[model samples]
Target chain A: MKPTSKFGVLILVAPAVFIYAFAVLLPFVGTIALSFARWNGFGTPEFAGFDNYIRAFHDTVFVSSFGHMLFYIATTLVVEVAMGLLLAGVISSGRFMGYPRVALFIPVMLPMVVIAVLWGAVFNPDFGAMNAFLSAIGREDWRQVWLGNPATALPAISLVSGWIFAGFYMAIFNAAFARLPQDVIESARLDGANERTLFWRIKVPMIRQVSSVAMLLCITGGIQGFDLFYVMTNGGPYNSTEVPTTYMVKAVFRDMEIGFGSSLSVILTIVGLVIAIFFRKWRSTRQEDVEY
Target chain B: MRIDPKKLRRLLVSVVMTMSVALTSACGSSSEEGDKTLRIAFGSNGSDGQKVWDQAAAKFEADNPGWKVEFQVQNDDLYQTVGLQNLLTSNNAPDVYFEWAGARLVNKVNAGYAADITDLVSSSGLDQQFAEGAFGTTSVDGKVYMVPFTSDVTNVIWYNKDMFAEKGLSAPTTWAEFLTLCEKLKSEGVTPLAVGNKDLWVAGNWIGHLISRSAGESVYDKVMSKQMPMNSPEFVKGLTYLTDLQKGGYVNASANTIPDNEGYNLFLQGSAAMLPIGSWLIGIAQEQAPDINLGWFNLPAIDGGAGSQESIMGVTTGYIVNAKSTKQDKAVEFLKDAFSADLVGAWNAAGFTVVAKSADAGTLDPVTQSMVDLLNSGASIVAPPDTGYDLKMADALNTAIAQVLDGVKTPQEALDEAQAKVETQ
Candidate 1:
């Protein structure tokens, strides 16, 4: 077969490269430049050097927002990725036959705004479903203003994020499970490997690459998560649930502090990239690849 | 499909040209520079708000042929998020737009977005149509930039009169009496105040006023102007009242979570005995719970309060034409028609407290009439912080209040936090 010419390859890939650069790369470069300026979304932007970055370090709200992001990442990893892995394993073992895959994925299909509205009612301090459920169970002491309390808000938001995305991860894991070598599993089963043992030792290890990817998505998605947090809490109860995005939005749009907002965005992007790179490095062990 | 290099080069060039044309067309605005249609952008008011605008448009169009009115409507949150800062800088800035008075109005003028309408108003004697002091709020640097539309009595104790009567209670007239009334309400197992402070501005406006009364207007002015620190003793003393309300459990447990509408609804549905909101509540109640009877009272007098005891937290909203617009005259005429007898009467019938002294007294309902009477009663209107001063400073102040209200921190500590935020800003 004839090899493609260099110019032909360049011509073919040019559109995709150009679109990527325009959409992602250009804005990223612009944000970095804007991070050093003092702009209020009007008039000319004045160059302020590292003032915004310096301010972010000294500002409690800006620094605390990352703390919220970490909690969000930790909670979502467990609920979404781990829960999905477990649910997939349980289904693959035929123990959870009654729960349909379609039913599980339904929450993932709903729009985020709809989800936020639904959960907002659910966590509403006065007459929300969570409080009602708690009262009905004779656990009135456990009732809480879920989204209002600073202590509970970030966790509650993470739980909502998990509820929406868990089934998505489950779908991914289930598909990966289906493609696993049946002969090895049958061999393990014949050797008196129980369901739990099979899942833990055989299946889980075989899906290392998939698990790595899932964790990567979870981390990056957590860093970028804004909508539910914005709609449900809006970094309120004194900026308790403020992730970088919400604070960025407030600074740029609400406060008209565009320079500070751009700095926050740049910080978020860098954090996302760092986490992705670190995860890739940690997951790139040559021995983890299982040969057929 | 594989092609020769010469043909491929030509193809790529054609594709580039086509893409540029497509992108250019996509970016082109629907309204051209020479368009006869005039734009007036504003946030969502209640359904009746549209009626007033429509009447204004119809009136304006009837008199001025070959011209049309277009409204760019956005939700309140969306409007607040983008606001005039983004709009004025954009290519599609509204020719006429609704704006709040005070710092926001001044900022618009400072940025040259607000057209000076003093000449327009005085020359036509339209300035005489407004109630006394209405123009003051809409003015910046001695130049009127906005035409006063509605003066919102921003924070008032809007009580369910039916609930009060059933409970054998009346509106309190002083701080001590108000606390006793709150205690009585709590003993009666009724939430005294349903505050949705999630937006910060809801109860923040009231708290700002309360603090202003306690701290004195001069101290309040200094702090808001950033001449004095937010964590000053005067501010802390003013916030003590809020903490008292919070610790007393007179406010809803979910005050920090729910939006103002939900809190107002809680009062409207008789779930909560009182809601400290604004004159705007009537507009919302008229739509959702029309038959509900509500009564209004200013913030009760504080003992030894440094400011005027009868002060009320309020702000005016008005429309301004773009400074750069060629249709400035047309926009001003459109604004005049919006305040014309029939249109303003429509506003009053819809329960809005129109700022015009010329608004028909008979058009106002009892509750609205009482509000207008309060204005006439020589009560000082303390502008709410969000619109009346720097938004960031207001936000920091509001956050401090929320922290204290939620049992998250002491008033002094919260104010310190606010001071920290202000310093960073």
Candidate 2:
């Protein structure tokens, strides 16, 4: 481009760049700097020289939160992505496709707070639909206080998270499947390829880029999980549902341990960035130079 | 250099907007405008609280011209946690803000956010009006900071009177009798205790009561002052007592799953026979389930325990002046008016149990009057343990309570872990 055109492009991008720097970059840097201090979100911040980071490493709850984050990410990847892919495939194939597609996407349109509260009521041990269903089916022994039990709280929350976003991912995958060259699938069918073979070997490979993006998003969303648990459980039942984000929030806002919370945020951001970059690189390698 | 009229107009508008933004940002700085405005923040309770505060503000404004009071009411939970801290850190903090007593209020004083109102408290002679030891939580290093207005009695075990009557039971006055009462209630297929442990503090209050009854106030005083570890035998015994009650199936099985409101519903609906909670429960119960025949009793005393049978566990809600406020004198004057007989009586009529001993409660609802009478007559009142522990320690203890009750950990183990964490902190 010519110099004048380049200058115009820079001018066009200036507002966005300024916003990103002011909102994101500055806070990111501040958080990193704060990780080394012992401030309580007030008064002079005393320099602690990596005490917060070291404490995070030694803190049992902090360590468990990271583990929970990983579990959340992995669960979202498997549950949401698999369900999304299945829904998309069904819709694209024009089989088992109906108004249910709209129903699936409705959860994504609902506010997260509403979804959390709805699911919380549903999971209520006593007077909830889940227990009521169990009683109706005469399976009362199998019924559990879903969010109140430490063993089941995280998984229950993860399942709700998947239910909330599966449709959004399904929409993305459906669009990708629509853009596929149908002739290739028809040709595969004529070549005696069964539906399973067509899907696992052909359609799956064809939508690899979309799937990679979905996986990255799912993983990142899980690691940053907060609102649902904040509304639903507040990481209760003895902090069983705690992930890094919720723990960080409690530390900074509730406990007023700004320095410690900042360290947790820094760690969470770094880990998320590393995983995201890994997925990006993996996605790049899937591009074969040949045209379909 | 000829300018288009439209372009000149646009240029002027942009300059004007920029200058306005700059001035708006500058307005937040700590400088006096023409009128001396005192931003007074309180924990809000819908329109009733607003009306009462508005009247109080009007009265203060009438008495002191050239001074203004801007009232802001915040949610109770937020005010307890981030609201006060955020205000204290900001340059435009409220001249006076509502606060809960104990470590929460003391934390502010320690952080130098609350003004030393010792002289003001003494000069106003308000110290004589408040109950003895009521100001303990609001004081730091023998200096007063908070001026309490309401004391909530947390150790009361509110029970369904009709249920107790039907079962031929009466409120027990001793721990052994309480256990027997629980067993009798259980045999009748009624849950003995209605608690929503999901909030954790609801259950924590019970633990506080048991500890107060089992080991007494001296141990807790040591623990609060860091002289005794939290895992002392007294605390462990307290935890064991609660766990034993859980093991005996006295509490609702789904108690851990429900919030405080739902647990109260269990009592209101007659599914549970009793609920041990603060004085606030009465007002909330009256508002939500007025028809329920509610009766209350203090925690039953333990036999051969060091604690006094008459001492109750609770917290007092109060106001604290900002250390950085320029209108400290005016703020103190406003607080004096705010706690006057008529104002406090008005608050009591609005369903609040103001701590001021001189405040009249004749117009209060029956339950609120009973609660006020209990507060006034109780031998000694101690703040909840959660209020004395730092927020993190309090949370850990509360979680430990839940875990122990859930059979996730033994009481000894839970207390040990909590004490270790608290000590390290």
Candidate 3:
């Protein structure tokens, strides 16, 4: 390209760059700066280099919140991805299922807060559908306080979250499966490649990129899980279901510790960036140079 | 390059139109209000309080021809959680609003956000009319910052009279008898106390009452003021009593998971024998379970404690004007009119124990009347420990207490850690 044309392109991109800087970059920089100060969101902030970070380090609540996020992310990744992939494979292969896939995907279309409230009702200790079902099956003693018990609160919330998002992942994998070459599948079938082998050897390997993308989305979303936990538990039964974002909100807004809250947000941002970078590198290294 | 002038003109016209629309909408929304309009924001106090406030506002507006009152009521999540502090600091704070008394208001007052109402109270002769402790909560550093609206009697042991009768029980007047009653109630397959620690404050109510009983009102006052350590022997003994209540199965094992409504429901449904909550529970009991046959008594004294049975936990919810209010004169006028003899009488008629000289104590609900009598008859009132500590210290202590109730930590361990936090803060 000519130098004058390059200059013209740069001039054309100037407005977009300005918009990004004002809208996104400014807030990002402000948050980072605030992380190093002691602010109560009401008065003048005092500079306290690394003090907020040190407080975050010592805060047992923050540590517990991190553990909660990890548990939620791991359980959600395992359940949603595996179930999504299996269901996507089955639905794409012209199985016995007809409207079942559509029915399953309905949850993905609903708002997460609605899903949380619905699940909360279903898990009600006294008069819940789950308890009713248990009583009908002669297992009344097995009925559990699903959202109230610290032992089961996180898992129950994770299950609701997974149910809400799994359908989206399933739809993604299903679309990816549709774009796969039919000839390879036909040839594999002709060669007596069993159903399991076809899925494992051909379909799975082909959709590695889609799975990687899905996993990345899951990781980022899981790390920032706030609304579901907030609506369902508010990180209670004694902060047992707390996540990083919830903890940050409680500190910044509830306790008026804006500085410490910002530090937590910075930590979350760094962890998210590291994961994204690691995944990008792994993706690039694993990519095959295919000529079509 | 050749440009189509028509297309260029059209694009320019569209952009101009969009900008104009945006500017117009902004201006339309930004229009200023009349000077007579007084906007107040308060936490939503359920349907009953809403009705009473609505009636009062209507009456206020009707009496004042040109003045208008705009009442904004939201959930506790919005008002009590964090949004209230934000509102107080911002230019958008209400002219007058209800706030939790004690250290919560003290923080705002010390920050110079609330107006001093000392002159108003004195000139208006409210000091003589209101209860003794009513002026105490809003007074800080010799200046009054708020007007007490209603007093909450916090040591009331609301019990199901039907359940007590069925179990052949009577109200216990001493600590030993209270424990004996609890044991008997528990052995009879009823949860002795339908206590809920879900919101932390619900549990704090019980703990504060226990402290008042075990440590005496003076010790509670000193502890709340931070003159005594939280881990002091008296305070520790109070917590020990609470832990024993938990261990003895007097409290619901799952109470930590139950919210206030659910815990109240248990007591209402006869699943629990007692619920030691505020006198406000009387209204709730009347509304939810009118036929439950309820009775209340002050918390009994411990055998070897210095406290008297007359001591109780009492805090008043009141209104404060914004220090930066443009209509400060009008706000004070509204307060004066609102707390007038007729208005206070109206409030008394509406079941509230209003802190006004004009409030006819005899006209209050039977329960509220009794509570007023209790307050007037020289019952010692103690504020919660959090009423003295800073915001961070208070929240940390409340959360730690919740954890203790969940069996995550012993009372001593929790108090020790909480003490360290309070001292640091």
Q: Which prediction has the highest lDDT against the true structure? A: 1
Best by TM-score: 1
Q: What is the TM-score, restricted to chain A, for candidate 2?
A: 0.92
lDDT per residue, candidate 2, B1-425, as tens digits? 65455555566557657866887889676666564888988667678777778887899889888777887678877877777677777766798988778777777777887999889887877676667877876777888888887777877899988888887999999988999999999998888988887778888877777777778888867765677877888878877878768778888877776788888888888888999888777778778888888898888878877788888787777899998887887888888777777777777777677776655447776777787777778577776767756776667678778888787888889888877766545
RMSD of 3: 4.1
**Index of the highest-DockQ prediction:** 1
Model 2, residue B186: C-alpha shift (Å): 2.2
Task: Spell out the clash pairs found in candidate 3.
Answer: none
Clashes (N, CA, C under 3 Å) per candidate:
0, 2, 0
- Model 3 lDDT tens row, B206-260: 6776776787877766766678777777877777777767568688765665678
Q: For model 3, what is the alpha-carbon lDDT of residue B176?
A: 79
Give per-residue CA lDDT, model 2, range A1-292, as digits (tens).
3343444455446657867997999998999899999988678999999788888887787788888888888888877998899888777777757788999999999999999989989998867899899999999898998888888888888899889888999999999888889899899999999877887888988888788888888888887789988878887878777888888888898788999889989899888899889878877886773257
Interface RMSD, one decimal, each candidate: 2.1, 4.8, 5.1
Question: Where does candidate 3 stray beyond 4 Å?
Answer: A1-26, A125-144, A286-292, B1-36, B45-68, B85-93, B124-133, B215-234, B306-309, B349-351, B385-389, B417-425
Off by over 4 Å in 1: A1-18, A98-100, A285-287, B1-12, B18-37
Poorest lDDT segment (10 consecutive residues) of candidate 3 chain B: B385-394
- lDDT per residue, candidate 1, A26-122, as tens digits? 9888889999999877788999999999998888898999999999999999999999998889888876666577777899999998999999999
